[model samples]
Target: MEELFKEYEDKIPAILLEELKSSIDKKTTKTQLKKMLEALYEEYLESMVEPGESVGIISAESIGEPSTQMTLNTFHFAGVAEMNVTMGLPRIIEILDARKNIKTPMMEVYLKEPYNKGKDIRKVAELIKETKMSDIIQEVSINILEATITVKLDRQKMKDLEVRDSSVKRAVEKQLKSGQVKIEGDEVLIKVKSKDDSLNDLYKLKEKMKSIYLKGVKGITQVLPVKRKDEFVIITAGSNLKDTFKLEFVDTERTTSNDIMEVYENLGIEAARAAIINEVYRVIESQGLNVDIRHIMLIADTMTASGSVKGITRYGVVSDKSSVLARASFETPIKHLINASLVGETDPLNSVIENVMLNQPIPVGTGLPGLITKVKK
Candidate 1:
């Protein structure tokens, strides 16, 4: 312990040194400790990049090569035909593109103690799933002669969804701006009171009435309670992270959404950075391929370093480059050249791509070392 501090006092932090001492005492023998320390030193040395080493090329090659083996089609979930996750190369593109809206937005909501232990899980699922007036409507009929619209609600479906008939009537009346909302048995009838209101008005009312917000959390279309290991978790079809986090029984720390922008908006950039790494890692791992996590981490860091998520496309990271040649190399060379000419932009030839394009030695590795000659005496 004394020798470790003496040798690595300047190199390793005090907090990390203390942790190492505690870990060594609890988890390792003297022979294992020596090997572990050596391994740590070697890992530290291997983690660094040479001054001029091109990280962008390495990262692109590392991920792009393995992605070719990924499947082209979407993978279906068992027992649920509607839920299909975008996998393989397409998913990889989505993450790199940093699209505002993904092909499928989903959420995994974890519960608190009692709820997580399988108590009233189905009830919770019902509470989280969004239910609209149209979801329970048996039929909607528009009357051109009477200039009225009548909606028939399914009694059994309403009972199953725990939606009251009175609540449905209130929502329709509010939308239609009518006080005389006649509820006859399971049917709701509304007629145009003014002579100016035509058949088109009644048809518009029918369309608007069906989309009325009835009950449950908004934006969540479907909910499925799945069992993993020892606990039951709710998988939602739509992601409403802001509203979902407000639930009293939800475990906010463990609850996560697949929408990258949603995570960025609510949780900030650090969480957004983590989400990118996790998502890319998940896609690759799902395809039964093992990749070094550091490569994915590098990409995530670059995307979020500007304090917002940026795609690899011309509109994003490429546009943000300092060198004019680097941006031109990515896409639309003539456009970039014309824009640079208009702005009178100068290329410093500092980076790898720009220097390589001009057939000059890059300012990295051996190229970085310069020798000075003394004046002749």
Candidate 2:
């Protein structure tokens, strides 16, 4: 086989050759092998992009057309009304814009070994689900006359949340360091340390008790254990990728966050790029749109090419464009033009936008060819 394709060895890619070699079995014939190679070669040629093609425009149009038909709403999770996933046009927009803080930031956390096999999933969910002081408290009553605040703890709720009286007392004392917190049966008494503490101060302390961190992972507002295929997974309302990965039972490789910047910062630019493409594709596919993955890949590559996740907007990827005309063409023409002029920038008319701005044929496809004159010899 090597001798048969010796002439075309340099032409064929090494990866394709390796794939062909790995796919062949002992019973495979020389004729069958030759035919398969030919078919693969044809496929490789057919998939190649044409020189000077306006791929950017094509990609934009491919995705943009289907996006208009997408629903501008989130899908509610069955049995969990609070867990609504941001899908459709809004989700696509959020991903493309690379918003630092997403509206409904979430995480799909995969577990390892026995945990993934559905062992103690509810307990794991309870452990990670952020428990605030307000969640366990039945009510708060302030006694202005006594200059003290009384917080009634829900013992049943605390038991369900897997929290103890000692833990609650410790958390309250540590959180309200300015005040003295004493656990009296199921009630927590908060008294101001200052002898001259006013009624307003007592009221303020009572209000502060509502948001104190009691237990569980920070930023993980809610966690729901879900069964997928043969494994159990945790879907969270809020995301904290960095800390979530540190959990012993978590499958770090499979865990992902919806926030692009969070992924970029914690996972790296490459992961962010993949996340952008997958996220956009997921949104599009969820809406039953058939936009090609290549289009999403182009958008993802553009967003993460600068070693950082950037939005497709004027302030993000557009602002980083080397071509002044390209930047000006996106949005805010005056701002781009003034900034370019102030910096003594020159438009070489090498790109599509700059050439088009001057009422010239854009340097793409047939327009890319320069006129050549022949001299008689």
Candidate 3:
């Protein structure tokens, strides 16, 4: 039994090391790494693998965190001046495992010295807030207007412009009684009840004034236009519109160049951009396509960088160096075998035998096959 355990332990590390190497070569994003690990864990369970059978074999949850915080300190180690890392989720796991301090799947680690505490957490929170806000504003429109006041009319509270002989109250009453002015809410409206040709001229002037104000507002809201081969493209310039594009699905069909331009005219450039990105993301998600959040993030970044939305790629935000073989190797029963070998002090071959005796999961691409041994006389 001891010899068998030793054999299993030796093989466990070898398998795990190979998996780590593959992960590095592929430059797998953090999300991909997590998915690969989860698939392997499922295989381990089916094979009924046990702990202490492998080296460097950890639970799936050990390396999985929805968010990660890293803290670094600049210092000199061995005459090398550089940044020394003190705290991070990954580092914490490594330290705890090295010391065999915990066996739980999820845990947290805190640092004491050489670390600027709470800084990274604050930064991450701020960034998330900014991202969420940008996402929300991507669909809205902004407009600014300036207008000139015309036909000003005023009635004095005093009955006489010469106030030497009149009381203020009496003068105010006289103004209200007269048809010289009208008050609507806080505004004073002067009635221009005249059929003179000059009144028509005044009306025309008011219309012109309003038109000019609208044009000025439109100019401020104008955004950079995209040059398409056969059509003109336009997008808003605002973080909110960019973020709205992050949604899984919203509305894409209505997000054409003309529609975007219309938004620019009605809402302004910032609101138009937000609307377009939101619509684009909505369309992509509605098609049942699987895309990483990082891909969307990259698109937003590219749009901002070039001041136009175009040229997004899979490899832009995330890599595609996936390996089926490497993924399968990590899923094997090798970890359990290695742990058992190390604990029982045996060899790889013996470890396999003992694992089989325990009816534990064995390493296979999808799952370990059931085997039957026959005795001959």
**Best lDDT among the predictions, by candidate number:** 2
Q: What is the lDDT of residue 200 in candidate 1?
A: 74
What is the Å distance of residue 312 in model 2 from its true position? 0.4
- Per residue, candidate 1 scores C-alpha lDDT tens digits across 140-259 of 887777777788989999988898978987877787684357889988887767646766777777787788888777899889898879999999988999989999999999999999
Q: Using Cα atoms with residue i matched to residue i, what is each candidate's TM-score against the true structure?
A: 0.87, 0.88, 0.18
Each prediction's RMSD over C-alphas, in Å, is 3.7, 3.3, 26.1
Winner on TM-score (2 vs 3) = 2
Instruction: Give the CA lDDT, 0 to 100, for residue 368 in model 3.
Output: 44
lDDT of 3 at 174: 49
Best by TM-score: 2
lDDT of 3 by residue, 320-363 (tens): 11322222233344654464456773334223333455576544
List model 2 lDDT by residue over 216-275, tens digit each. 788898888888898888999899988888889889989998889999999899999999
Poorest 10 consecutive residues by lDDT, candidate 1: 22-31
Scanning candidate 2 in windows of ten residues, the lowest lDDT window is 2-11
lDDT of each: 0.85, 0.86, 0.33
Ranking by TM-score: 2, 1, 3
Count clashes in each candidate, considering only residues at least 3 apart in sequence or on different chains. 1, 0, 44
